[model samples]
Target: MVLYQIYPRSFADSDGDGAGDLQGVIDRVGYLELLGVDGVWLSPIMRSPGADHGYDVSDPRDVDPLFGDVDTLRHLVEALHAARMVLIMDLVPNHTSVEHPWFDAALAAGPGSPERERYFFRDGLGEDGSQPPNNWPSVFGGPAWTRVTEPDGTPGQWYLHLFAPEQPDLDWSHPDVGDDLDETLRFWLDLGVDGFRIDVAHGLAKPDDLADLPDDVEIAQLVVDQRDARWDRPGVHDVHRRIRAVVDEYPGAATFGEVWVGPVDRFARYLRPDELHFAFHFALTGAPFEAGAVREAIDSTLEASRIAGSAPTWALSNHDVVREVTRYGNGTLGTARARAMLLVELALPGITFLYEGSELGLPSDYSIPHDRLTDPTWERSGHAEMGRDHCRVPIPWEGSRPPYGFSTSDHTWLPMPASWGCLTVEAQIEDPESTLSLYRAAIETRRAWPGPRSASVEWYGAPSGCLAFRRDDGVVCALNTSDRSVPLPRGEVLLSSGPLPSGPLASESPTGGVLPPDTAVWLRPH
Candidate 1:
């Protein structure tokens, strides 16, 4: 099934509050239905302190006022279902905002409080009272531990936060914690959401004994804590099985997990039948724009699915990474290359996630002034020397309107890129050759031909600046990565990203015809 990702704040502002809300999403249900996506995955909309956007949730059952209340969310979900679309909400169970009542109660009750054990808290002070129990650093920068004062006027202990200091990691080992999560899942499932996209799903469990990182490592020490404990723990599968049982009680329900790791083998484990229905393969999205590399990634993912006996999901851009267009487009790549990339991703096996702005062929804008930056990552790690604000920019909807129809108000949470005015949904919808139309066409084509249960794919030529492949359905795809035309053999063109040249294919030829640079062609073999 085709899935669309909506970054709530940047999607559309129905109330013109300068920030998108559930009502705004409900208003755009027709837009998504018309776009031909079967499902939509919204970023977190739960109650939070906005520490890491909505990822740092304070209440699991309530909706964040920034997005809307519970009633508005229910209406949005109903609208999507009425349009024959599924709605998937983000589930951030890894941590909670420090402002959450549970955390506050834990801090106030000291070590003896029953709720205190629900979180990771240390007793006694470090050599310096301000120091943490271990040398772990926060993912956002600084020490992972934040000191909390005790009620008795004593120096309080520090707590561990894998991400920002305000987001403290949950103690999954606690029995009550698991029960709380199970109840949370049921709460949403009863609300009629199709499923949940579990944030950091692999991070539910951690090593019992906290450890320190190597002295020479330059990356944040928090990485060590996460890698060493939370991710891919054997115990995590049990937790998944329990959650799966809960989801199974509801028909047509599913789960997707965000398992970020370099090894595809480890990532695939999260997709076991009893575990997550699917987990994102970030490796393919992170690969360079090389044909061989792309082929290798695709093949590896397919192989991993076979080994794991589970379906996989593919993604190019999300709230977490740089945009696909900005990553691959260098001003010279042209729209042809971008379209080819889309075809590659769509043709791959399993579910596909389309980020909000990718259909418009929008590239990330790196011109955000320092003062305009809202991403916490920008302020921490010095922007990681890899600006992410570009991908997080507000989406452009109306071509001529100021802020590109993202917001009617004078100011937005994040500045809209200047280039958005000319590249918007309203502008492209009317243009037959526009990327917006192409995306709609592509989605329709995929819907029409779901492909064989097991489609065989073969490479027919070298991947030197150009690549050619044949699918099981007698469809041949030829892509030219350079600017020059590439010769092709005789074949009837089925689809093309750009203008097609006049030609007829023979049974066999000594050499193929030339293809225009950055262009792609799908043909039927003679």
Candidate 2:
């Protein structure tokens, strides 16, 4: 399935609120259908305080007003289903907003109260309880433990927040936590959501001891090491098993996880038939435009999925990472490379995810000013890391100006780059050589490709700095990753990521038609 990820805030605004809403998504179902996506995987739109975006869920069962109300969500689900597309909601089960009612009760209740027990509430270490219980740090930086005041106004116990302070991690060990999430799953399932993309899926369980991190451990801003006490604990599988049972009640429903485990074997565990349908295989997301790295990522991901007897996922860009257009080289070269990779990714055997704006070949706006940054990582890293705001900028839909038809208001939640005028959907659709046109043609060609449905890839021997693979259906996909052009494989050209070299393509010759660098092509074997 081609899964299109819609980061709501930057997608399309319907009410002139500078934020994309459920109605906005409903209005764009036609656009998605035209893009050839079979389903839409929406980022979190649940009730939140906007701290850490929607990841800090205050109410799992209700839609956030920023997006729309419950009725609007129902309409959206129906609209997508009517269009023969599936809607996969983002589920944030690892934590809740500090403003949530349960958290409020947890604060009001004494240290040993059941409400307090629902979370990881612990008395501080050292005399007068002035120190954190452990040395683990938050994913967003700083200490993960936040000390709260008691009813009498004195210093009280500390709570664990794996991310921002506004997001307090839930104690999954508590049976009530599992029941609460189960109820949340059923609530949305009843509303017609086809599935869920579980947020922070590897972070549900914590080490039982809550021990201090090893002193030698390396810490990257907003990245938790897989071996860290706060992530990928063995007990997390129990939570997945329970969720799978709930999802099984509704046949045809699936669940994908946001797991970042290190080893492919461990990553595959999350996709075990009973755990999750699949997890985002980000191995290829930020890879440079090189053949070896790309090949390793593909082979590793396929091997893992093969071991699990499940289909893998491939995506080059997403909301949380730098856009591929910016990462590959960040200009004309970057755009070309990104388009080439799209052909390679889509031709692979598995579910493929396309981040919003990717089809338009949008680049991240690295110039977004400091004061305008909203991602917690910006502040948590002491300005050393600029965060993902650049990648989350509002997309250009039409026109040649700032708002660019994304919203009625001149201002948006995140500023739109003026340079995107030429990349607007209206602009690209009119140009046959535009990125949008290329994507449309590629997806259309993919839909019509007569190929055996096999989850395997056969590598073809090729010159250095180039890679070739043949599918079971006799379709050969070739990618030239070098700076110079190379000979094309023997086959009938189905689609080319970019324009072919001048002259006609010759069949049955290893040194046939030239394949330009940063170009990919699909050919039916002669």
Candidate 3:
């Protein structure tokens, strides 16, 4: 399946409120249908306090006013359904916004109360309880545990927040969490959402003891490496099983995770039949633009998925990382490589998630004034890191300048570049050579391509720094990572990321013309 991720705040603003709302998604249903997506995976729109965006769920069963109300969400679901597309809402089960009612009660109830039991409320270390419970650090930065004052207005206990302080980690071992999740799943299912994208899916369960990491182990590496006390705990599988059970009640529903575990095998564990329908394997997402690196990542993840007896998933860009254009090398080369990778990703057998603005070949905006940066990582890291605001900029829809028709207002939650006038949707809609057009053509070709639902691939030998792979059926996708043009495979070129070199036709030459560097082509072998 091909799913498009729409970051709500950056997609399109319906109200002139500087934020995209549920009405925005409703208005854009036709645009998604035109893009040929099977479904829309919306980033969190759940009720939040704008802490960590909507990922810090204030009310899992309701919509955030920043996005819209619950009734508007129903309209979005209905609109997507009318367009023959499913709606997959993002949910944060790992934690909730500190402003959530539960967290408020947890604070008022103080330590050892049932309300406080829902989260990790522990006494600090040292004689005066001044230190944190452990040495764990927040994923954003600084201490993971934040001390909370008692109802009596005195320093009392600390709570764990693996991410920002606005997000307090829930205790999955507590029956309250399980009960709340059950109610949440049913609420959305009843609301007509076809599926869910579980945020930090592998992080719900923490070790009972909350042990400190070894002195040599980096705090940041805990989640990536397996067997860590903080994340990917064995009990996490139980949490998935519970989610799957609830989702199974609704026919045709799916549950996928935003897993970032290392060594594909561990990542595969989250894909067991009774657990998640699919788990994201991010090896390719982080791989450098090189033939060997990409090949190894693909092979390992596929094999791991095969071993786990679940379908594989491929995703290039997401909200958390740098845009592919910037990652690949930026400017012309970056756009070319980004386009090339999209072709390769689509050619693979499995679901492919297209990030918003990726089809238009949008690059990260480096010119955002530092003061306007909203990602918490900036302040959390003490300004040492600028965070992901560069990539999370509002999309250029159809206008000549800032806001780019994304909003009727001149202002956007995040600024859009005036230079993006050339990259607007209206500018590329009719240009055959535009990145938008290439994406349209590629998606159309892929839908019609002959192949089994579960297809296999065989690697083809090629020049150094180039990789070629063919579907068991007959389609071949070859990519050139080298700096120079390499001979194209002898096949009828179906689609290409960039232009191919001119020479003798495939019928005349065994290798045809050279394939441009940092480009990829899809072909039907003779």
Candidate 4:
């Protein structure tokens, strides 16, 4: 499926409240249809206190006023359905906002109560319960355990928060936890949500002992290393199987996990037939701009999905990482490379998730002043990490100045770059040479290509610093990573990420086309 990810607060604002609501998405359904996406994968929109930008859900069954009411969400589903598209809700089963009623009751119920049992509450490790229970650090950069003061005003048990202090990790081992999440799944499924994207799917289950991690583990390794104490435990697969059982109850409804595991076999475990329909394997997301890195990422991801007997997922950038345009080097050069990568990503088999503003080639606004930063990581990390706010800036949809039609308000939730006028969607819509146009053309072409019966890709021999792969259907994708031009494979050019070279496409060579440095092309065998 060609799914588009919309970060609600930053997409578009209909009430002029400086935050995007469900109505904004409804109004933009036409745009999504034109872009050829099969569906939308909306980020968290449930009841929240705005911590972690809705990831800290206070109520999983209701809509947040910050976005809209239940009726608004229903209308959004209707709109997308009318356009022959579906809605995949983001579900956070790992933790809950400290403001949640369960958490409040857990705090007031004191130690050993059933309420406290729903979360990871334990006595401190030191004399008089003075120190934290364990050394596991929060993903945001501090000790994971937070000691709570009892009603009598003495420091009592410590609760674990793998993320921020305001997000308490739920005890998946608790029976009530599974029952509540099952109810949540049904609640949205009944409301017309087609599927779910489980947030932190690898993090829901943990070791029973609550063991201490080694000193060398860093927060970044949480997504990379399967050995990290806080992630990828064997228990998580059982959790997925439980969720899959519920999703299977409703025909046509599917679920995918945000699993951060390693190697093909290890990653494939989460996608066993009894578990998730698919698990987002992030090999491609972390790849660099070079051809070799990109090839390895794709090969590994394909192998993993093949082992799982499921479809693969391709994503270049997402809410948490620096935008691809900026990662490839930020400028005219960066934009060119980003375009090349997108073409390469799109030409591959399987589902593709296009992040918001990617078609307009919006680079992450690293210039967002430190004072305006709002991601919890900024404070939790003691300002050492700037966090993801730079990538979460409001979309520049139209107009030439600030806000760029994202909101009518003078100030948005995050500061948008004034220099983005030229990158606005309105500026790129009709310009055939613009990045938006390239996306439209590419998506349309990809949808039309009748891929091979077997989805596997066959690698074509290519020169140094270049890579070429052919599908069994005779469609070939070539990318040039060297500083010089290279001959394209023997095929008719279907689409290219950039302008082709002048002078007969270097006809003197056996091949019929010249691929410029940092460019990619899709072709049908001649």
Candidate 5:
């Protein structure tokens, strides 16, 4: 099934609040239905302080006012189902906002309090009240722990925060934590959501005995201390199995996990019959955009999925990474190269995540002024390269409107790129040669050419240059990786990034024609 990812704040603003909301998303369900995708994966919309956008959730069951109320969210879900599309909510279980009731209560309870036990609170006293429990850095930057005063008017112990200081890591070791999570899942499942996209699913558990980083590993120490406590611990399987049981109670519901590390084989662990149904395989998204690298990633993912007895999910871009167009689309390579990458992703086995604006071939806007930056990574890392705000700019819907239909007012949470006026939905929808039109055709072709889910891929040329691959459907995908094209063998061209050649060829000489760079073609035996 085809999947679309919607970064809520940047999608569409129906109320024109300058920030996208649930109602705005509901208004666009028709657009998604028309695009022919089976489902949409929404980024987190739960109650949060917006510290890390919506990932740092304070309340799991309630909708944030910034997005909308619970009623608005429920209505959006209903609208999605009515349009014959599934809705998947982002589930951030690894951590919670420090403002969350649970965390606040834990902090107030102080040391020796049962509520504090629910979190990772280490007593700072050494043999004579002199040292910390362990040295660990936060994922954002600096020390993972922060001191606070307890309600008892005493110097409180420090608490662990893997991400931002405001986002306290949850104590999965506590049984009550699982119960709370299950209740939250049941709350959403009862609302008829198709499934959940679990965030940092591999990082649900940590070693019970918190350990310091090895003294010899400088990088590991600089970053967060390698904590075996959280992430891929054997105990996490229990939590997944339990969640799976809850999901099974509601047939047709599914679970996808965000697993960041481990081999493909290890990734499959999350997809155990009793756990998640699929986990995102990000190997290709990070690999160099070359045919050989692409082939190896695809083949390895397939093999790993096969061994795990589960299917894999592929994603090229998301809220966290740079836009695929800018990442892989060298402006000089022309549209052909862009289309070739699309073909490879579409033709590969398993579910494909189409990030919002990806269909319109939107490029990342890196012109954010220093003063307007919103991403915490930029401030915390003191490095502009670490932030992802460029890729998270508002989508361009209106051709001439300032902010490109994202906002009518002078200000928006993030400014729409200046190029959005030229690269917008309205302009592209009317042009037959537009990227949006090509994407539509590609989606339709993929659905029409249903083949074995376990199809094997065979690479046929140099990794960086022109390449060919045979799909299970018997169609050969020939792609010219360079700006110039090499001659094609005998075949009828089914589709091409550019116009079709003049003559029907039996066996043409190896004529080096101009490919306009980065173009792709689908061919079938004449």
Candidate 6:
């Protein structure tokens, strides 16, 4: 299945507030249908303090006022269903905003209170409890523990937050936390949501001891560390099993996880038959635009998922990462590589996730003013990493200038580039060779392929800096990642990301296909 992910805040805005809302998503169902996606997965829209952009949920059961009220979300769900589309909400169960009622209760009922037990509230280390319980640093670059002022108006216990201070990690060991999440899942399922995309899925179950990090260990290393990291613990699988039980009650429901654990075998555990249906294969997301590296990522990702009896989920750009077009290097070369990689990603045998604006080949805005940067990484890293705000800018939809008909007001939550006039949907819909058109053509062709659905990839011998794979259906997808043209596989051309080399050889070649540099083509063996 091809799932289109919409970062709701930057997708579109119905009201002149410069922020995307439920009405904005409702208005775009037609566009999603035109894009030919099987379903739409929305990022967090739950009530939040906006500390980690909605990841820090203040309420799991209600929609944020910034996005819309509960009624508006219901309307959006109905609209999507009416269009034969499914809606998947992002579930952030690992943490909650510091302002969340439970967290607030924990703070008020402090010092050995039961409410404090619901989270990782521990006494500080050292005499008088001044130091943190451990040396673990936050993913955003500061100390993971934050000292809280007690209700008695004195220095008090410290709380753990793996991401931001505002996003306090929940005590999954506490049964109530799991029970509450079950209710949250059923609340949305009853309201007609098809499934959920679990955020930070691997980080739910923390080490029981909460021991200090080793001297040489870094928080960043924890992401790829399969050994005794705070994430991807054995207990996390049990949590997923319980969530899967709730999802199983609703027939046809799905669960996708955002798991970044490494050593493919360990990462695959999240997708065991009783856990998540699939987890995002982020290896490809970080892979540079090189054939060998991408092929290796695809192979390892598929193999691991296969062992776990789960489908692999492929994605390129997302709200957290720099946009693919810009990531490939940035200008003509970047756009071309992005287009080529999209074909490779789609042709792979698995569920694919298309980030919003990827079809338009949007570029991240590196020029976002320093003051406007909201990602905690910027401040946590002491202004070293600009963070992901650049990719979160509102997309251009129509018209000639900034906002480009995306919102009533010229202002947007994140500024759009003036040069985006040419990439608007209105302009690209008519241009057959535009990135949007290529996406439409590829999706239509892929949907029509009379192939057996398989989660396995069959690699074909190919030239250096090139990759060719035969899908289970005998459709050969080839990509040339080099700076020169490459021979096309002997097959009938189905769709090409770009034009083939122009010559008699191109004509005499199988189905007149000769892959140009940084181009990909889907072929049907004749």
**What are the TM-scores, per candidate, against the unseen true structure?**
0.92, 0.97, 0.97, 0.98, 0.92, 0.97
Off by over 4 Å in 1: 216-227, 332-334, 382-387, 482-484, 502-513
lDDT of 1 by residue, 1-526 (tens): 8899999988888777888888888888888987899989999999988978898889999999998899898898899998999999999888899889889899888877888888888764556576677776666766678888888887778788877787888888888778988899998889889999998887777677766655554443222333454356778888888889888899999998887654666766777778888777676787667776777777777766776777667888898777777678644363556777787777665789999988988887457777877777666667654435678777888857557777788577777766566678889888988888888987887777646465336878744777777767666777767545657644876667767553342123323444566677777777
Off by over 4 Å in 4: 221-226, 503-505
lDDT of 1: 0.77
Off by over 4 Å in 3: 453-455, 503-511
Quality of model 3 by C-alpha lDDT: 0.87
Candidate 5 is scored at a TM of: 0.92
User: Candidate 6: misplaced stretches above 4 Å?
Assistant: 504-513
Give the whole-model CA lDDT for all candidates, comma-separated: 0.77, 0.87, 0.87, 0.89, 0.76, 0.88
The local distance difference test score of model 6 is 0.88
**Candidate 2: what lDDT?**
0.87
Give the winner by lDDT: 4
* Per-residue accuracy of model 3 over 234-317 as CA lDDT, tens digit each: 899999999999999999999889887887667888988899998888888888999999998889778868878887888899
Candidate 2 shows a clash count of: 0
Off by over 4 Å in 2: 220-226, 503-511
Single out the weakest 10-residue window by summed lDDT for candidate 1.
502-511
lDDT (Cα, tens digit) per residue for candidate 2, span 1-526: 8889999988899999888888888888899888888889999999999988899989999989999999998998898889899999999988999999999999998789999877899999999999999998887878899999999899999999988999999989998999998999999999999999999898898887899888766554223455566777899898999999999999999999887775788888888878998887677875678999899989888888888888888999889888998888888898999999999998998889999999999998459877889999989878878878888988899999989999998879988887888999989987889999988888888778675477899999988999999888777889999987777887888888888865453453554678988999999886
Clashes per candidate (backbone, < 3 Å): 12, 0, 0, 0, 12, 0
Tell me how far the alpha carbon of residue 323 in candidate 4 is from the true structure, in angstroms, after superposition: 0.3
Over all chains combined, what TM-score does candidate 1 have? 0.92
Lowest lDDT 10-mer window, candidate 2?
218-227
Report the lDDT of model 6 for residue 140.
Answer: 92
Which residue pairs clash in candidate 4? none
